[model samples]
Target: MSSTTETFEQYLHNFIESDWLSAIHTLLPEIHEVDRNAVQIWFRFYPLSLFRYLQSAEDLEKAVQGFAMLGRYELKDQIDTSHHFLYGHRYWKTVKAAIEAEAVVFENDDIDLAEEIRQLAAMSAEKLKIDVSLVIAIAAVGMMTLNQTGLENFKNAADGIQKPTGLMAKSPDKIVSERSKDDSQGVFGFLKTVNKKYSIIYDEKRNDGRFAITSDQEIAGASALDRSQNWQEKDSRCWEGVIPVECLSASCGTCWIGVIAGQEKLSEVSRRERKQMKVFGYNQPEGERPFMRLSCQAKASGNATIVIPPWNGVFGKKIYQNVQDVELEPATTSARELRKVVSEAAINKAE
Candidate 1:
């Protein structure tokens, strides 16, 4: 298994085996009070998130309401109100234990005991995803109650993982597959059958496109394109004056392409590809899977269609920096001239 897949599986296994299970079990009495269907749906997508929150929660009412908030209000209304009351009651039981054990402290020690009951009612706001915005909102509420600077530290922490775009979107695999199929048929109809069986597709019409492999295939020798001399002529279209490749190694990202279809079908990512893709800036977010890859590095055993990027260039970092500088350049000519003079002076001093 690829390290990425192995790491994910290990994470899941560790969570299952650790104190997380004990924490969830402790929540059973409270969880039972929630609408059975709502609880089931919430657990499906957010078992880990809920478990983590429960283990850390300062109060029981807040903990129970937190999980309930994961479900939409419209759906919650469909369930029995008795279930909701029971859910709240059970959650508070755990919260009272946490407070008694000194796991979480309240800002106002003097507040009447009834305030704790009211706090649970306030926690039913239905924003899920537990993203930066949610974290910021929680901090804001804490600051309002505590009259302190806790929100600033929380904001700084959230900023580290925030994306340039607010949306946490992933590329659709089916769309990629369809594009690969269209491109392959348009360029190399005769090679379709062979290309389908293997993960890589070669198109001579585009930049002398050579072999394209799926992300997961194990390459023999140096790279995926490397083949024995006997099979080289028969397997490689470049040998038949079809698609030409200058270098078979990653030195040339020439074989870069968008995964047309079946990204899941491709091999799980490797350490080398992960590093190289970052260097190339093809994969921007740390959490995202790369959509483009070097064909020579990626090997596919199953069917996948791919579309080649128009051009390949090394020195990706320099290109990215230059683009950013230009975009941020001052609008006035005077500012531009001053910037240019300062840049020249810095260069001369370095030399």
Candidate 2:
């Protein structure tokens, strides 16, 4: 395994491996207070959506590349966050099915298949209560192990309850969160004391974690753009350590960000922001606040952890293909039945 893969593995491990019910209560006390079940259910299946796209990869190396690509693009556009909230059990079953489909179980004389099954049964029996997040992590780790090694190796590792450690973090490839350490000690440090500023942690590869904005300030992406202006002046299109921003007024979809934490503390999504998000095809109007939000539209009221996408494009209305209209023949059926038939006919015609 490469250092890049190892670093990401550790990051993923730290991000999802937790006693989530307690963790959510700690990090998002308000959310847990109002609806503890909702928060707990959401975090339980968080690993499912996080690891779902990786099922398509043919090998461990490709899976790492897929992970990196996911940081850049919204790959699973069809599966929104609400699906997990409403149908977590079904969603998790599907994820497990995908993983099992990709995984290969050995059936050789040297490997006791029955014993392996019994061990797996014992493990499941031990944790009968729904700690779904840990179960998913275990399966995900097993899949990664199978990819790097063979099925027999995975069985052995699983039997011994040993996590597969393919690669170790190296000095040159250490994933560090970049923070502005000089902010409090500079000549302009006094200016920061005037207002209540909150830190925004960019949780992507760049890990640009030092951008701070005053209370009720414009989104974190804008702050990042201001901080990186010198670099932008050097190269107008540079986005090395900056959150990509084209039109800061929420016109372009270039500044969409995923709120990994502190979402509730952020200012409410405005009417214009909601409309623009729908136009950008990044959000649905089903909820007041969503995990996926336009950074330009979302103001930071407190510290937030956000993930920036790799690329952006305008596809609001363009995502839909042209549809042909159809005239239904008059029938003796009731109006409701006729309308249903017409709808079915139109769908069939579209197909």
Candidate 3:
């Protein structure tokens, strides 16, 4: 068997986009479009740098503990389900169990990870009553779990942590169908100026997650929520709406949402949006419109679905302290003060 170190770094490196994309294509006919996007988003969100950071750590516990956002996120255990915010997460436990059983029975050191996952996916399909696509994605998660925490921890199951609801629990088909829903009858919509109305499914438990954006110009943040619902029942400060928003201007970072589907429908990520996301330590990579976005800044022109992270933090300077060339644009009073602190630290190092 490959050492845990080899297995962990192997997938992060050579597995590459093409490898997973290849799997996505092979399973396209069997997997729902939503589940396919979930795989793509999972790969994007859990970056290679994260794995390298963990792998190269002299002390794993310290590395995890010293993380800028440590304790801010509930990802202490079940390393495999780190991407659970994506769709089809409900199938993870079943898929991981089956994969573990196979690994034990074979004890094959030269195991082809991809082929092994594919075969396990096929075998679980009949019993799980779920699509092969989802099983395939979750199986990959199982492999990652094994590589990250070993089989002993993988089998223990996560305890006491409460995962997000709605999309994680729903079937892929139902999640995808949400995007096609519309209720817009606006003059511009009827005239084909824009999609009449786009539904934003944030949480699907009892329809608390779904909302209609009738106006093409409306941003999917606090303002939109207020327009759609009566905020009188609860304080609109935060978590009062389907998508929480502390500052509708993207300064607070509370409105960031992961694009589960329909990312193309959302407006392009602005320079300001990119800056805020970086300072918020949500997503630091550069892309025209990343899977991670500030809901206060993204306006939808078509149907879309998104996942609201259970937590948010402003730790960009700490997280990307070593990253060079990327200039950070500070927002809000607190973030600007944070910049000053970082600047002082840099000056101290130079001295």
Q: Each candidate: what lDDT?
A: 0.32, 0.41, 0.57
Candidate 2 lDDT by residue in tens digits, 1-351:
444434333333333323333334443332212122333333322333224334444584543432222222322321222222221222333333333433333223232222332333234434455333323322332333333333333333322111212111111122111221112435665566445667776532233434766666767444554554464554343343356655456654556766655677677877666765544435333466666677767876666655555444332332221223333232323323334432332233211
lDDT of 1 by residue, 1-351 (tens): 344433322333343312333433333343222121122222222224333434455894553432222122221122112112111222322222322222133344443222332332234222222212112222112222111112223222221121211111222232233334423334555555554434343321233233434224532212334342443354332321222222444433334445534444555566655554433334322333344555555566455444433223232232223212111133334335334432332122100
Which regions of candidate 2 fall more than 4 Å away from where they truly are?
A: 1-132, 135-194, 204-208, 220-222, 225-241, 318-351
Question: What is the Cα-based lDDT of residue 254 in candidate 2?
Answer: 52
- What ranking of all candidate models by TM-score puts the best one first? 3, 2, 1
Give TM-scores for every candidate, taking all chains together and pairing residue i with residue i.
Answer: 0.28, 0.42, 0.67
Question: lDDT: which is higher, 2 or 3?
Answer: 3
Cα lDDT of model 3 by residue, 220-339, tens digit:
452345445664344333444566554466655556677767777778888777766665556434577666788878887776777655555444544444422234345556546445
Tell me the deviation in Å of residue 160 in model 2: 23
lDDT comparison, 1 vs 3, better candidate: 3
Clash pairs, model 3 backbone: 203-209
